[model samples]
Target: MVKAKQINVNNLPISILDINEDDYFCLTHMTKNQQEGSKIIEKWLTNKNTIEFLGVWEQLNNPNFNSHEFGGIMSEAGTNRFYLSVKQWVERTKAMGITARTGKYGGTYAHKDIAFNFGLYISPLFNLLLIKEFQRLKEIENNQYGLEWNVKRILSKANYHIQTDAINNYIIPTLNYSQKKEWIYADEADLLNIVLFGCTAKQWRDANPERSLNGENIRDIASINELTILSNIESLNSTLIKNNVDKKNRFKILLETVQEQRRTLDNIDFIKSMK
Candidate 1:
Protein backbone atom coordinates (compact mmCIF):
# COMPACT_ATOMS: atom_id res chain seq x y z
CA MET A 1 0.00 0.00 0.00
CA VAL A 2 1.12 3.58 -0.66
CA LYS A 3 1.89 5.83 2.31
CA ALA A 4 0.41 9.33 2.25
CA LYS A 5 2.03 12.49 3.61
CA GLN A 6 1.27 16.19 3.23
CA ILE A 7 3.11 19.48 3.15
CA ASN A 8 1.62 22.96 3.24
CA VAL A 9 2.91 24.90 0.25
CA ASN A 10 2.20 28.58 1.00
CA ASN A 11 -0.70 27.63 3.33
CA LEU A 12 -2.19 25.28 0.75
CA PRO A 13 -1.99 21.62 1.72
CA ILE A 14 -0.61 19.38 -1.01
CA SER A 15 -0.69 15.61 -0.53
CA ILE A 16 2.26 13.36 -1.41
CA LEU A 17 2.22 9.62 -1.84
CA ASP A 18 5.12 7.20 -1.42
CA ILE A 19 4.81 5.07 -4.52
CA ASN A 20 7.48 2.39 -4.76
CA GLU A 21 10.02 4.66 -2.98
CA ASP A 22 9.27 7.64 -5.26
CA ASP A 23 7.23 10.65 -4.12
CA TYR A 24 4.15 11.60 -6.17
CA PHE A 25 2.65 14.99 -5.36
CA CYS A 26 -1.07 15.62 -5.74
CA LEU A 27 -1.63 17.78 -8.80
CA THR A 28 -5.32 18.02 -7.90
CA HIS A 29 -4.43 19.58 -4.56
CA MET A 30 -2.03 22.00 -6.25
CA THR A 31 -4.89 23.37 -8.37
CA LYS A 32 -7.61 23.22 -5.72
CA ASN A 33 -7.32 26.91 -4.74
CA GLN A 34 -7.93 27.98 -8.33
CA GLN A 35 -11.40 28.51 -9.82
CA GLU A 36 -10.87 25.48 -12.06
CA GLY A 37 -10.05 22.36 -10.05
CA SER A 38 -9.15 19.46 -12.38
CA LYS A 39 -9.69 21.42 -15.59
CA ILE A 40 -6.29 23.02 -15.08
CA ILE A 41 -4.75 19.54 -15.02
CA GLU A 42 -6.79 18.53 -18.05
CA LYS A 43 -5.65 21.64 -19.91
CA TRP A 44 -2.04 21.00 -18.91
CA LEU A 45 -2.26 17.41 -20.17
CA THR A 46 -3.50 18.61 -23.59
CA ASN A 47 -0.51 20.92 -24.11
CA LYS A 48 1.90 19.57 -26.74
CA ASN A 49 4.95 20.59 -24.65
CA THR A 50 3.47 18.87 -21.57
CA ILE A 51 2.87 15.70 -23.57
CA GLU A 52 6.42 15.77 -24.88
CA PHE A 53 7.80 16.38 -21.37
CA LEU A 54 5.76 13.46 -19.99
CA GLY A 55 6.76 11.21 -22.87
CA VAL A 56 10.46 11.90 -22.30
CA TRP A 57 10.09 11.40 -18.52
CA GLU A 58 8.32 8.07 -18.98
CA GLN A 59 10.90 6.91 -21.53
CA LEU A 60 13.68 7.62 -19.04
CA ASN A 61 12.06 6.16 -15.90
CA ASN A 62 9.52 3.57 -17.06
CA PRO A 63 10.76 0.69 -19.15
CA ASN A 64 7.19 -0.55 -19.66
CA PHE A 65 6.02 2.75 -21.15
CA ASN A 66 4.26 2.22 -24.50
CA SER A 67 6.10 4.60 -26.79
CA HIS A 68 3.83 3.53 -29.70
CA GLU A 69 0.75 4.71 -27.79
CA PHE A 70 2.54 7.86 -26.57
CA GLY A 71 3.44 8.77 -30.16
CA GLY A 72 -0.22 8.48 -31.14
CA ILE A 73 -1.28 10.72 -28.24
CA MET A 74 1.54 13.18 -28.92
CA SER A 75 0.43 13.64 -32.52
CA GLU A 76 -3.08 14.75 -31.40
CA ALA A 77 -1.89 17.18 -28.70
CA GLY A 78 -3.02 20.88 -28.76
CA THR A 79 -5.79 20.09 -31.26
CA ASN A 80 -9.30 21.48 -30.67
CA ARG A 81 -10.83 17.99 -30.55
CA PHE A 82 -8.12 16.42 -28.36
CA TYR A 83 -8.66 15.95 -24.64
CA LEU A 84 -6.87 13.77 -22.06
CA SER A 85 -7.19 12.80 -18.42
CA VAL A 86 -4.60 11.44 -16.02
CA LYS A 87 -6.27 8.00 -16.07
CA GLN A 88 -6.40 7.92 -19.84
CA TRP A 89 -2.74 8.92 -20.16
CA VAL A 90 -1.69 6.18 -17.72
CA GLU A 91 -3.86 3.50 -19.35
CA ARG A 92 -2.79 4.34 -22.88
CA THR A 93 0.93 4.85 -22.29
CA LYS A 94 1.66 2.56 -19.29
CA ALA A 95 3.04 5.66 -17.60
CA MET A 96 4.69 5.51 -14.17
CA GLY A 97 5.46 9.21 -13.74
CA ILE A 98 1.86 10.08 -12.85
CA THR A 99 -1.10 8.24 -11.40
CA ALA A 100 -4.82 8.86 -10.79
CA ARG A 101 -5.57 7.63 -7.33
CA THR A 102 -9.03 7.14 -5.76
CA GLY A 103 -10.23 7.01 -2.15
CA LYS A 104 -9.85 9.55 0.67
CA TYR A 105 -6.64 10.98 -0.83
CA GLY A 106 -7.93 10.69 -4.37
CA GLY A 107 -6.21 12.99 -6.85
CA THR A 108 -4.04 13.23 -9.97
CA TYR A 109 -0.62 12.66 -8.46
CA ALA A 110 2.55 13.12 -10.52
CA HIS A 111 6.11 12.12 -9.78
CA LYS A 112 8.14 14.92 -8.16
CA ASP A 113 9.79 15.75 -11.48
CA ILE A 114 6.44 16.27 -13.15
CA ALA A 115 4.80 17.85 -10.12
CA PHE A 116 7.54 20.47 -9.87
CA ASN A 117 7.07 21.22 -13.55
CA PHE A 118 3.32 21.56 -12.92
CA GLY A 119 4.08 23.85 -9.99
CA LEU A 120 6.13 26.01 -12.36
CA TYR A 121 3.20 25.99 -14.74
CA ILE A 122 0.92 27.21 -11.92
CA SER A 123 3.32 30.04 -10.96
CA PRO A 124 7.04 30.43 -10.30
CA LEU A 125 6.35 31.63 -6.73
CA PHE A 126 4.15 28.61 -5.94
CA ASN A 127 6.74 26.25 -7.40
CA LEU A 128 9.49 27.82 -5.27
CA LEU A 129 7.42 27.54 -2.11
CA LEU A 130 6.50 23.91 -2.84
CA ILE A 131 10.12 22.89 -3.41
CA LYS A 132 11.27 24.65 -0.23
CA GLU A 133 8.52 23.08 1.87
CA PHE A 134 9.14 19.61 0.45
CA GLN A 135 12.89 19.90 1.16
CA ARG A 136 12.15 21.01 4.73
CA LEU A 137 9.94 17.97 5.26
CA LYS A 138 12.69 15.68 3.95
CA GLU A 139 15.25 17.33 6.25
CA ILE A 140 13.03 16.77 9.29
CA GLU A 141 12.53 13.13 8.34
CA ASN A 142 16.26 12.60 7.80
CA ASN A 143 17.12 14.14 11.17
CA GLN A 144 14.58 11.99 12.99
CA TYR A 145 15.82 8.87 11.18
CA GLY A 146 19.46 9.57 12.10
CA LEU A 147 18.58 10.32 15.73
CA GLU A 148 16.70 7.03 16.18
CA TRP A 149 19.41 5.00 14.45
CA ASN A 150 22.12 6.44 16.71
CA VAL A 151 19.98 5.88 19.80
CA LYS A 152 19.46 2.21 18.95
CA ARG A 153 23.16 1.71 18.15
CA ILE A 154 24.20 3.31 21.44
CA LEU A 155 21.70 1.21 23.40
CA SER A 156 23.09 -1.94 21.82
CA LYS A 157 26.61 -0.96 22.83
CA ALA A 158 25.58 -0.22 26.42
CA ASN A 159 23.85 -3.59 26.66
CA TYR A 160 26.88 -5.31 25.18
CA HIS A 161 29.01 -3.94 28.01
CA ILE A 162 26.48 -5.20 30.53
CA GLN A 163 26.68 -8.69 29.05
CA THR A 164 30.50 -8.57 29.11
CA ASP A 165 30.40 -7.55 32.76
CA ALA A 166 28.39 -10.68 33.53
CA ILE A 167 30.99 -12.71 31.71
CA ASN A 168 33.78 -11.16 33.81
CA ASN A 169 31.92 -11.72 37.06
CA TYR A 170 30.60 -15.22 36.46
CA ILE A 171 31.67 -17.06 33.28
CA ILE A 172 35.31 -15.98 33.29
CA PRO A 173 36.01 -17.32 36.79
CA THR A 174 35.30 -20.93 35.75
CA LEU A 175 37.47 -20.71 32.62
CA ASN A 176 41.06 -22.03 32.69
CA TYR A 177 42.67 -19.54 30.27
CA SER A 178 45.44 -17.49 31.90
CA GLN A 179 46.95 -15.00 29.43
CA LYS A 180 44.45 -15.29 26.55
CA LYS A 181 41.05 -15.17 28.24
CA GLU A 182 39.62 -12.74 25.67
CA TRP A 183 38.26 -15.73 23.75
CA ILE A 184 35.69 -16.19 26.53
CA TYR A 185 34.18 -12.76 25.77
CA ALA A 186 34.30 -13.51 22.04
CA ASP A 187 32.58 -16.84 22.64
CA GLU A 188 29.74 -15.24 24.62
CA ALA A 189 29.32 -12.52 21.99
CA ASP A 190 29.27 -15.10 19.22
CA LEU A 191 26.64 -17.03 21.18
CA LEU A 192 24.28 -14.05 21.02
CA ASN A 193 25.23 -13.37 17.40
CA ILE A 194 24.58 -16.94 16.36
CA VAL A 195 21.22 -17.02 18.15
CA LEU A 196 19.96 -13.76 16.64
CA PHE A 197 21.67 -13.66 13.22
CA GLY A 198 22.37 -17.34 12.65
CA CYS A 199 26.03 -16.51 11.98
CA THR A 200 29.16 -15.71 13.92
CA ALA A 201 31.12 -12.46 13.31
CA LYS A 202 33.82 -14.24 11.34
CA GLN A 203 31.26 -16.15 9.33
CA TRP A 204 29.38 -12.96 8.49
CA ARG A 205 32.59 -11.20 7.54
CA ASP A 206 33.56 -14.09 5.30
CA ALA A 207 30.19 -14.02 3.60
CA ASN A 208 30.31 -10.21 3.08
CA PRO A 209 33.85 -9.47 2.02
CA GLU A 210 33.03 -6.04 0.55
CA ARG A 211 31.39 -4.76 3.75
CA SER A 212 34.15 -6.30 5.81
CA LEU A 213 36.73 -4.58 3.63
CA ASN A 214 35.03 -1.29 4.44
CA GLY A 215 35.45 -2.01 8.19
CA GLU A 216 31.74 -2.58 8.73
CA ASN A 217 30.86 -5.55 10.91
CA ILE A 218 27.54 -7.33 11.10
CA ARG A 219 26.18 -5.14 13.92
CA ASP A 220 27.48 -1.97 12.26
CA ILE A 221 25.07 -2.39 9.34
CA ALA A 222 22.16 -3.98 11.21
CA SER A 223 18.78 -2.29 10.93
CA ILE A 224 17.25 -0.39 13.86
CA ASN A 225 14.95 -3.36 14.54
CA GLU A 226 17.85 -5.79 14.57
CA LEU A 227 19.85 -3.55 16.91
CA THR A 228 16.89 -3.29 19.28
CA ILE A 229 16.55 -7.06 19.24
CA LEU A 230 20.30 -7.47 19.73
CA SER A 231 20.18 -5.16 22.75
CA ASN A 232 17.31 -7.15 24.25
CA ILE A 233 19.00 -10.52 23.72
CA GLU A 234 22.29 -9.22 25.08
CA SER A 235 20.67 -8.11 28.31
CA LEU A 236 18.75 -11.36 28.55
CA ASN A 237 21.89 -13.43 27.90
CA SER A 238 23.71 -11.55 30.66
CA THR A 239 20.93 -12.36 33.10
CA LEU A 240 21.02 -16.00 32.04
CA ILE A 241 24.80 -16.10 32.55
CA LYS A 242 24.43 -14.64 36.06
CA ASN A 243 21.86 -17.33 36.82
CA ASN A 244 24.52 -19.95 35.95
CA VAL A 245 22.68 -21.29 32.94
CA ASP A 246 24.93 -23.45 30.79
CA LYS A 247 26.05 -22.10 27.40
CA LYS A 248 23.96 -24.62 25.44
CA ASN A 249 20.77 -23.87 27.38
CA ARG A 250 21.42 -20.12 27.15
CA PHE A 251 21.79 -20.43 23.39
CA LYS A 252 18.43 -22.19 23.12
CA ILE A 253 16.70 -19.58 25.28
CA LEU A 254 18.32 -16.67 23.44
CA LEU A 255 17.37 -18.22 20.08
CA GLU A 256 13.74 -18.58 21.15
CA THR A 257 13.67 -15.04 22.54
CA VAL A 258 15.16 -13.65 19.33
CA GLN A 259 12.53 -15.41 17.20
CA GLU A 260 9.63 -14.18 19.37
CA GLN A 261 10.90 -10.60 19.64
CA ARG A 262 11.52 -10.40 15.89
CA ARG A 263 8.00 -11.62 15.15
CA THR A 264 6.55 -9.02 17.52
CA LEU A 265 8.72 -6.11 16.33
CA ASP A 266 8.17 -6.93 12.67
CA ASN A 267 4.45 -6.20 13.09
CA ILE A 268 4.95 -2.81 14.78
CA ASP A 269 4.63 0.16 12.42
CA PHE A 270 6.66 2.45 14.67
CA ILE A 271 9.57 0.02 14.66
CA LYS A 272 9.31 -0.41 10.90
CA SER A 273 9.45 3.38 10.47
CA MET A 274 12.74 3.57 12.36
CA LYS A 275 14.31 1.32 9.76
Candidate 2:
Protein backbone atom coordinates (compact mmCIF):
# COMPACT_ATOMS: atom_id res chain seq x y z
CA MET A 1 0.00 0.00 0.00
CA VAL A 2 1.15 3.56 -0.80
CA LYS A 3 1.21 6.31 1.84
CA ALA A 4 -0.39 9.68 1.09
CA LYS A 5 1.12 13.06 2.01
CA GLN A 6 -0.23 16.58 1.64
CA ILE A 7 1.33 19.93 0.71
CA ASN A 8 -0.54 23.20 0.56
CA VAL A 9 -0.20 25.30 -2.57
CA ASN A 10 -1.64 28.85 -2.16
CA ASN A 11 -4.02 27.70 0.59
CA LEU A 12 -4.95 24.73 -1.59
CA PRO A 13 -4.18 21.33 -0.05
CA ILE A 14 -2.80 19.05 -2.76
CA SER A 15 -2.67 15.32 -2.03
CA ILE A 16 0.58 13.62 -3.02
CA LEU A 17 1.36 9.90 -3.27
CA ASP A 18 4.82 8.31 -3.01
CA ILE A 19 5.27 5.47 -5.53
CA ASN A 20 8.81 4.06 -5.85
CA GLU A 21 10.27 7.39 -4.61
CA ASP A 22 8.47 9.44 -7.30
CA ASP A 23 5.87 12.07 -6.39
CA TYR A 24 2.41 12.11 -7.97
CA PHE A 25 0.04 14.99 -7.18
CA CYS A 26 -3.68 14.29 -6.99
CA LEU A 27 -5.52 16.13 -9.81
CA THR A 28 -8.64 15.76 -7.67
CA HIS A 29 -7.12 17.97 -4.95
CA MET A 30 -6.06 20.52 -7.54
CA THR A 31 -9.73 20.73 -8.64
CA LYS A 32 -11.02 21.33 -5.11
CA ASN A 33 -11.32 25.08 -5.77
CA GLN A 34 -12.89 24.59 -9.19
CA GLN A 35 -16.57 24.17 -10.07
CA GLU A 36 -15.83 20.82 -11.76
CA GLY A 37 -12.32 19.39 -11.25
CA SER A 38 -12.91 15.89 -12.66
CA LYS A 39 -14.20 17.40 -15.88
CA ILE A 40 -11.04 19.51 -16.12
CA ILE A 41 -8.80 16.37 -16.08
CA GLU A 42 -11.04 14.66 -18.67
CA LYS A 43 -10.78 17.73 -20.92
CA TRP A 44 -6.96 17.82 -20.56
CA LEU A 45 -6.69 14.15 -21.55
CA THR A 46 -8.66 14.63 -24.80
CA ASN A 47 -6.18 17.12 -26.28
CA LYS A 48 -3.83 15.94 -29.01
CA ASN A 49 -0.84 17.83 -27.49
CA THR A 50 -1.29 16.22 -24.02
CA ILE A 51 -1.23 12.72 -25.58
CA GLU A 52 1.96 13.51 -27.52
CA PHE A 53 3.81 14.77 -24.40
CA LEU A 54 2.68 11.75 -22.34
CA GLY A 55 3.69 9.38 -25.14
CA VAL A 56 7.20 10.82 -25.32
CA TRP A 57 7.62 10.71 -21.50
CA GLU A 58 6.53 7.05 -21.36
CA GLN A 59 8.97 6.09 -24.15
CA LEU A 60 11.90 7.64 -22.24
CA ASN A 61 11.06 6.30 -18.73
CA ASN A 62 9.01 3.14 -19.23
CA PRO A 63 10.48 0.26 -21.19
CA ASN A 64 7.14 -1.55 -20.93
CA PHE A 65 5.26 1.30 -22.69
CA ASN A 66 3.13 -0.17 -25.54
CA SER A 67 4.05 1.79 -28.67
CA HIS A 68 1.65 -0.19 -30.86
CA GLU A 69 -1.33 0.86 -28.72
CA PHE A 70 0.02 4.43 -28.38
CA GLY A 71 -0.03 4.74 -32.20
CA GLY A 72 -3.73 3.86 -32.20
CA ILE A 73 -4.35 6.41 -29.39
CA MET A 74 -2.56 9.33 -31.17
CA SER A 75 -4.52 8.60 -34.37
CA GLU A 76 -7.86 9.19 -32.59
CA ALA A 77 -6.78 12.35 -30.73
CA GLY A 78 -8.78 15.65 -31.02
CA THR A 79 -11.81 13.91 -32.59
CA ASN A 80 -15.25 14.86 -31.27
CA ARG A 81 -15.62 11.42 -29.64
CA PHE A 82 -11.98 11.26 -28.42
CA TYR A 83 -11.99 11.33 -24.62
CA LEU A 84 -9.62 9.79 -22.00
CA SER A 85 -9.42 9.22 -18.29
CA VAL A 86 -6.25 8.69 -16.22
CA LYS A 87 -7.36 5.05 -15.78
CA GLN A 88 -7.81 4.42 -19.53
CA TRP A 89 -4.46 6.08 -20.38
CA VAL A 90 -2.51 3.77 -18.03
CA GLU A 91 -4.45 0.65 -19.06
CA ARG A 92 -3.98 1.30 -22.81
CA THR A 93 -0.36 2.59 -22.79
CA LYS A 94 1.12 0.85 -19.71
CA ALA A 95 2.39 4.25 -18.54
CA MET A 96 3.97 4.63 -15.07
CA GLY A 97 4.17 8.45 -15.09
CA ILE A 98 0.51 8.92 -14.19
CA THR A 99 -1.83 6.81 -12.03
CA ALA A 100 -5.50 6.56 -10.98
CA ARG A 101 -5.51 5.98 -7.24
CA THR A 102 -8.22 5.03 -4.71
CA GLY A 103 -8.55 5.38 -0.92
CA LYS A 104 -7.32 8.32 1.23
CA TYR A 105 -5.12 10.08 -1.35
CA GLY A 106 -7.49 8.69 -3.97
CA GLY A 107 -8.03 10.51 -7.26
CA THR A 108 -6.26 10.94 -10.57
CA TYR A 109 -2.57 11.59 -9.75
CA ALA A 110 0.00 12.61 -12.35
CA HIS A 111 3.74 12.91 -12.19
CA LYS A 112 5.09 16.48 -11.78
CA ASP A 113 5.93 16.53 -15.50
CA ILE A 114 2.36 15.95 -16.72
CA ALA A 115 0.83 17.86 -13.80
CA PHE A 116 2.75 20.97 -14.92
CA ASN A 117 1.13 20.64 -18.34
CA PHE A 118 -2.25 20.48 -16.62
CA GLY A 119 -1.32 23.58 -14.63
CA LEU A 120 -0.60 25.38 -17.95
CA TYR A 121 -3.96 24.20 -19.30
CA ILE A 122 -5.63 25.47 -16.12
CA SER A 123 -3.84 28.88 -16.25
CA PRO A 124 -0.25 30.19 -16.32
CA LEU A 125 -0.76 32.04 -13.02
CA PHE A 126 -2.04 29.00 -11.09
CA ASN A 127 0.77 26.86 -12.53
CA LEU A 128 3.45 29.34 -11.36
CA LEU A 129 2.08 29.33 -7.80
CA LEU A 130 1.91 25.49 -7.81
CA ILE A 131 5.54 25.12 -8.88
CA LYS A 132 6.72 27.69 -6.31
CA GLU A 133 4.93 25.90 -3.44
CA PHE A 134 6.44 22.54 -4.43
CA GLN A 135 9.92 24.06 -4.50
CA ARG A 136 9.42 25.56 -1.04
CA LEU A 137 8.35 22.16 0.35
CA LYS A 138 11.48 20.57 -1.12
CA GLU A 139 13.73 23.18 0.51
CA ILE A 140 12.15 22.53 3.93
CA GLU A 141 12.69 18.78 3.57
CA ASN A 142 16.38 19.28 2.69
CA ASN A 143 16.97 21.51 5.71
CA GLN A 144 15.43 18.99 8.12
CA TYR A 145 17.55 16.16 6.65
CA GLY A 146 20.77 18.16 7.00
CA LEU A 147 19.96 19.04 10.63
CA GLU A 148 19.53 15.38 11.68
CA TRP A 149 22.80 14.41 9.99
CA ASN A 150 24.73 17.08 11.94
CA VAL A 151 23.26 15.91 15.25
CA LYS A 152 24.41 12.31 14.65
CA ARG A 153 27.90 13.50 13.64
CA ILE A 154 28.18 15.45 16.90
CA LEU A 155 27.31 12.36 18.96
CA SER A 156 29.88 10.21 17.15
CA LYS A 157 32.61 12.83 17.77
CA ALA A 158 31.73 13.05 21.46
CA ASN A 159 32.06 9.28 21.88
CA TYR A 160 35.40 9.30 20.03
CA HIS A 161 36.88 11.97 22.34
CA ILE A 162 35.69 10.26 25.54
CA GLN A 163 37.30 6.94 24.55
CA THR A 164 40.60 8.53 23.46
CA ASP A 165 40.92 10.66 26.61
CA ALA A 166 40.54 7.63 28.86
CA ILE A 167 43.19 5.69 26.96
CA ASN A 168 45.69 8.59 26.98
CA ASN A 169 45.53 9.41 30.73
CA TYR A 170 44.82 6.05 32.38
CA ILE A 171 46.17 3.29 30.12
CA ILE A 172 49.22 4.78 28.29
CA PRO A 173 51.38 6.01 31.23
CA THR A 174 51.18 2.55 32.89
CA LEU A 175 52.80 0.70 29.90
CA ASN A 176 55.79 -1.40 31.05
CA TYR A 177 59.23 -1.32 29.36
CA SER A 178 58.84 -4.72 27.55
CA GLN A 179 55.05 -4.09 26.99
CA LYS A 180 55.77 -0.67 25.45
CA LYS A 181 58.18 -2.21 22.94
CA GLU A 182 55.76 -5.05 22.01
CA TRP A 183 52.46 -3.12 21.70
CA ILE A 184 51.63 0.09 19.88
CA TYR A 185 50.25 3.07 21.84
CA ALA A 186 46.85 2.63 20.13
CA ASP A 187 46.42 -0.78 21.82
CA GLU A 188 45.46 1.08 25.04
CA ALA A 189 41.86 1.43 23.71
CA ASP A 190 41.50 -2.29 24.34
CA LEU A 191 41.88 -1.61 28.10
CA LEU A 192 38.31 -0.24 28.29
CA ASN A 193 37.19 -2.57 25.44
CA ILE A 194 37.76 -5.63 27.68
CA VAL A 195 35.91 -4.13 30.67
CA LEU A 196 32.75 -3.33 28.69
CA PHE A 197 32.71 -6.06 26.00
CA GLY A 198 34.17 -8.86 28.19
CA CYS A 199 36.74 -9.55 25.40
CA THR A 200 39.94 -7.99 24.10
CA ALA A 201 39.95 -6.46 20.59
CA LYS A 202 41.73 -9.46 19.01
CA GLN A 203 39.40 -11.96 20.70
CA TRP A 204 36.30 -10.08 19.51
CA ARG A 205 37.71 -9.95 15.96
CA ASP A 206 38.37 -13.73 15.89
CA ALA A 207 34.91 -14.55 17.30
CA ASN A 208 33.10 -12.53 14.60
CA PRO A 209 34.86 -13.17 11.31
CA GLU A 210 32.14 -11.60 9.13
CA ARG A 211 31.98 -8.28 10.98
CA SER A 212 35.77 -8.11 11.25
CA LEU A 213 36.07 -8.59 7.50
CA ASN A 214 33.59 -5.73 7.02
CA GLY A 215 35.91 -3.41 9.05
CA GLU A 216 33.62 -3.46 12.09
CA ASN A 217 34.86 -4.17 15.63
CA ILE A 218 33.08 -5.02 18.89
CA ARG A 219 32.86 -1.29 19.90
CA ASP A 220 31.34 -0.39 16.51
CA ILE A 221 28.41 -2.75 17.14
CA ALA A 222 27.88 -1.66 20.76
CA SER A 223 24.40 -0.67 21.90
CA ILE A 224 23.70 2.98 22.85
CA ASN A 225 23.60 1.88 26.49
CA GLU A 226 27.05 0.29 26.18
CA LEU A 227 28.52 3.42 24.62
CA THR A 228 26.94 5.61 27.30
CA ILE A 229 28.29 3.27 29.97
CA LEU A 230 31.70 3.34 28.28
CA SER A 231 31.67 7.17 28.23
CA ASN A 232 30.78 7.38 31.96
CA ILE A 233 33.45 4.90 33.08
CA GLU A 234 36.22 6.65 31.12
CA SER A 235 36.56 9.48 33.68
CA LEU A 236 36.11 7.08 36.57
CA ASN A 237 38.87 4.79 35.28
CA SER A 238 41.18 7.77 34.73
CA THR A 239 40.67 8.88 38.33
CA LEU A 240 41.38 5.36 39.61
CA ILE A 241 44.59 5.20 37.59
CA LYS A 242 45.85 8.52 39.11
CA ASN A 243 45.56 6.92 42.56
CA ASN A 244 47.89 4.03 41.52
CA VAL A 245 45.08 1.50 41.20
CA ASP A 246 46.18 -2.00 40.06
CA LYS A 247 44.78 -3.69 36.92
CA LYS A 248 42.59 -6.15 38.91
CA ASN A 249 41.15 -3.40 41.15
CA ARG A 250 40.52 -1.07 38.19
CA PHE A 251 38.69 -3.85 36.34
CA LYS A 252 36.38 -4.50 39.33
CA ILE A 253 35.61 -0.79 39.71
CA LEU A 254 35.06 -0.22 35.96
CA LEU A 255 32.77 -3.25 35.75
CA GLU A 256 30.62 -1.92 38.59
CA THR A 257 30.56 1.57 37.00
CA VAL A 258 29.30 0.06 33.68
CA GLN A 259 26.42 -1.78 35.36
CA GLU A 260 25.43 1.18 37.57
CA GLN A 261 25.44 3.69 34.66
CA ARG A 262 23.47 1.31 32.38
CA ARG A 263 20.78 0.91 35.05
CA THR A 264 20.56 4.67 35.65
CA LEU A 265 20.65 5.75 31.97
CA ASP A 266 18.18 3.09 30.81
CA ASN A 267 15.46 4.46 33.08
CA ILE A 268 15.72 8.16 32.17
CA ASP A 269 12.52 9.18 30.31
CA PHE A 270 14.21 11.52 27.85
CA ILE A 271 16.92 8.99 26.93
CA LYS A 272 14.30 6.26 26.46
CA SER A 273 12.32 8.66 24.28
CA MET A 274 15.37 9.09 22.03
CA LYS A 275 15.59 5.33 21.52
My TM-score estimates for the predictions, one after another, are 0.89, 0.65
Best by lDDT: 1
Candidate 2's C-alpha runs over 4 A off are: 169-275
lDDT of each: 0.89, 0.76
* Model 2 residue 211 distance off true place after TM-score fit, in angstroms: 26
Global lDDT of model 2 = 0.76
lDDT of 1 by residue, 178-240 (tens): 554588888888998888788999999999999999999989988767888999999999899
Worst 10 residues of 1 by lDDT: 266-275
lDDT of 2 by residue, 117-201 (tens): 8888888998998888889877876666455444544564475566556555656666645456325334545667877888888
